[model samples]
Target: MNFSSKLLQNAVEEFGRLPGVGKKTALRLVLHLLKQQDAEVARFTSSLNLLKEKIQYCKECYNISDEEVCEICLSVKRDKSTICVVEDTRDVMAIENTNQYQGVYHVLGGLISPMDGIGPSDLKIEGLIQRLRQGAVKEVILALSATMEGDTTIFYLYRKLKEFDVQVSTIARGIAFGGELEYVDEITLGRSILTRVPYERNVG
Candidate 1:
């Protein structure tokens, strides 16, 4: 797509930098935003600015939040004895939408992807071990994706947590092997969580 204005092209390029957004889609979005009322566009940009400036990670679970701790971690309604572990904040949101989980979450931030240079030390694994050491949690549910990296991370986590008194489990493979948790249908994700399996080190 050729643009007559360098400014417009630059805007489109910036928008295209977002994950999964192609150049065509970015151009369409930038044009749409330009067509909107000035006040409306201002509001949209302002909201994004606020997000960039104020977004914070929950200290306990590593989930994205506006405060030191996420609302789910702070909620008394959630089950304190069970924690659903996920790869990131997006996974947390995905499971939350299913409404099948009443337990709190522990966001690892990323899977243990050796190909991608991500390791256990790069995630929130230590914090999780500390949480278990607190002696309040009875179970830890591994709600990672079905990818090899996810499986590897779960294995490492299982080894680290096997010594703990807490029970470790993984969501059922309702989704395909390579499917991400966020992309799975809500019903399937919910059912997977409901019918979770014990974390077996020999499965690999």
Candidate 2:
């Protein structure tokens, strides 16, 4: 790729550093940005700079927020007794989108993946344990992803919380609503059969 200007090349290289962005895509983005007005470009750069400088992590859950406590943690409507443990802020957002769970969240920051050199000590496990020890929480929901790493983390957490009085539960895993048994993976299909729930009608 032949970039006439070093400034343009630098911008393209920086954009290319982003995940899933190829050099060609980065160059295209840089060219697009170059075509924008100076004021528009300033606003774009300013927003990015502001995000980097002003974004805060909730002290309680480590979720991204503008304040010390996130809106979810501060909400009085949320169930303080039920803490849904998740891998990251994305999981927190995903569950929130459903509007089904009214419980508070505990973001682990990451899973315990030995291959990735990530362990319990590297995550927010200590903070979660401390929060539980305070006695306000009655149930700890392990909402980690359905993977080997997720299973390992859940098992490790179960062992840790065994002495605690809090009830431990996992989100039900099963076939999708419209999925056929033949298409569903063996592990999920088997678990779905074993943990089948009664078909209850919604009143509303």
Q: How many clashing residue pairs are found in candidate 1?
A: 0
lDDT of 2 by residue, 98-193 (tens): 999998999999999999999999999998999998999999999999999999999999999998999999987888877987899998888888
Q: Which pairs clash (backbone N, Cα, C closer than 3 Å) in model 1?
A: none
lDDT string for model 1 (1-204, tens) is 779999999999999999999999999999999999999999999999999999999988989999999999999999989999998888988999988999999999899998889988999889999899999999999999877898899899999999999999998667677899999999789977886766683254
- Candidate lDDT scores, in order, read 0.91, 0.92
TM-score of each: 0.82, 0.91
| Residue-pair clashes per candidate | 0, 0
Error of 1 at 156 (Å): 0.7
